[model samples]
Target: MTASKISFACAPVIALLGMAWGIAMAISTDHSTAPVHAHLNLLGWVSLFLMGIYYKLHEEIDGLFLARIQAIIWAAASLLIALGIALIHMNNPVGDPIAAVMSIVLFLDMILFVVLVAKSRQ
Candidate 1:
């Protein structure tokens, strides 16, 4: 399938994963768990697959640029999740700071992606 189509496919998967995460979080009543669970859906299953489609559809974007941005997403997401989890599990690790940085990076990446896609349509 084309990359853009992959994005559509991934969106729901990510959403569903999000739901699962919510369910797990709700059922367990345990406040101390690794935040990796959130990232698993947000980055791994959701972002990876969604971005696959975004890149596929927004064919105008530089493949290399998108790939690089995606790599950054994965790195940041994973890092943030790891740190967040640590923080959640009773550690004051650099969780919030790291997650915040990654969130900003993700925003930048999305903006860049949108720009490239728009330019490509021209």
Candidate 2:
């Protein structure tokens, strides 16, 4: 399958994991990781799935190398955000910086995605 398809396929899996994590947090009465869980579901699952749909609907987007780059950045940033939040929830000193960096990366990734889409339509 194409990278776009792969990215889309990952959404539900991430969502399920996020749901499980939320349930675990609820059971444990710990909402400390709620930010990470929300990000996983929104950015990791929803955004990626939307990107995939865009690529699927517009074949021209699939031809752009930026599509692959966007997928890579999205996946990597999602992991970093999740990991960073988990670390912060556990009171790790390095977590804040990592999450901050990943937040910037996520913004840039979205910018790149927008550029790719705009270019594809031209």
Model 2 regions more than 4 Å off: none
In model 1, pairs of residues that clash are 3-53, 3-56, 4-56, 4-57, 6-53, 7-53, 35-85
Clashing pairs in 2: none
lDDT of 1 by residue, 42-75 (tens): 6656666656656666565635555555545554
| Candidate 1 overall lDDT versus native | 0.59
Model 2, 45-67: lDDT tens digits are 88888888888877877756778
TM-score of each: 0.55, 0.90
Predicted model with the maximum TM-score: 2
Candidate-wise lDDT, in order: 0.59, 0.83
Clash count list over all predictions: 7, 0
